[model samples]
Target: MDEVAAAIADPVRRHILTMLRDESLSAGDIATRFAISRPAVSRHLRVLRESGLVRDELVGRKRIYRLDPGPLAPLAEWLAGLAGGDRWERRLDALETEIYRTRRERRARGPVEHRREHTA
Candidate 1:
């Protein structure tokens, strides 16, 4: 999971994954889409491959890459858990504010003092 997270952390690798999402592309095809050198794109592909986010096939003299998306399942679930926890945290925060407001209002209104009549 750590490897998959780290792999997707880079913008280049994310873009590569997006590119491969639709269709498999040869290494040269992917490299051409970026302004970086072919070796740099190759390195990004290597990271994705090592993280199991992508699969590569050797066809003739070219290596074609495609998205695997299997390793992303755990990461997606973990993120969903965080989102749920965040919603609960927001609710708790609102409840705390309401409790404090109610206490302050009660304190302000508590025990009205009686006025003494002065008969002179």
Candidate 2:
């Protein structure tokens, strides 16, 4: 997970992953899309490949890269918990505590009788 996080920390690598998400592209194809040098793109690809975020195959003389999202599951799940589940749980627990405190305060205050004043 740490490897995947580190690999995606660079905007270049993230863009590469986004590109590969749709279709596989050869190393040359990817490099051409970026303003950076081919060697720089190759290094980013190597980091992604090592992290298992992408898989590559040598077809003929060209190396093709594709997104492999399986390894991202753990990271995605962790992010999901942070964004949704755990946050909601904390909010609901806070709400419940507030509700209990309000109820206790109301009980302590006792019921009040309504009184009307007539215009003189």
Candidate 3:
């Protein structure tokens, strides 16, 4: 999971994953989409492969890469846990209630008292 997160932390690698999500692409095809060198793209692919986010198959002389998506399950679950159950809505409702309570208390206090200070 750490490796998956690390691999996904790179913008280039994330883009690569998106590229491979719908369909597999040859290494050369993937490299051509980026301005970087083939070797550099290959290195990114290697990191993704090691992270289990991607899988590669050699088709004839070309290597085809595709998104694995299996390793991402843990990350997705962790994110969902972070989101909690209706956490945002509950927090907002609590805040609104507090605001209304404060307003009601202020209203119950009636008018503010003003005291004049005498010069020493």
TM-score of each: 0.71, 0.71, 0.71
Write the number of the candidate with greater lDDT, choosing between 1 and 3: 1
Q: Which candidate gets the maximum lDDT versus the true structure?
A: 1
Question: After superposition, which runs of candidate 2 have C-alpha atoms over 4 Å from their true positions?
Answer: 86-120
Model 3 poorest ten-residue lDDT run: 111-120
lDDT, residue 20, candidate 3: 92
All-Cα superposition RMSD per candidate: 7.7, 6.7, 7.3
Clashing pairs in 2: none
The CA lDDT at 105 in model 1 is 74
Q: How far is 39's C-alpha from truth in model 1 (Å)? A: 0.6
lDDT of 3 by residue, 1-120 (tens): 788999999999999999998899999999999999999999999999999999999999999998999999999889878888678888999999999998787677664521122232
Which residue pairs show collisions in model 3?
A: none
Q: In model 1, which regions exceed 4 Å deviation?
A: 85-120
Go through the candidates in order and give each one's C-alpha lDDT. 0.92, 0.91, 0.91
Q: Mind giving the per-residue lDDT tens digits that candidate 1 earns over 26-61?
A: 999999999999999989999999999999999999
Instruction: In model 1, state the lDDT of residue 49.
Output: 95
The segments of candidate 3 whose C-alpha lies over 4 angstroms from its true place after superposition are: 85-120
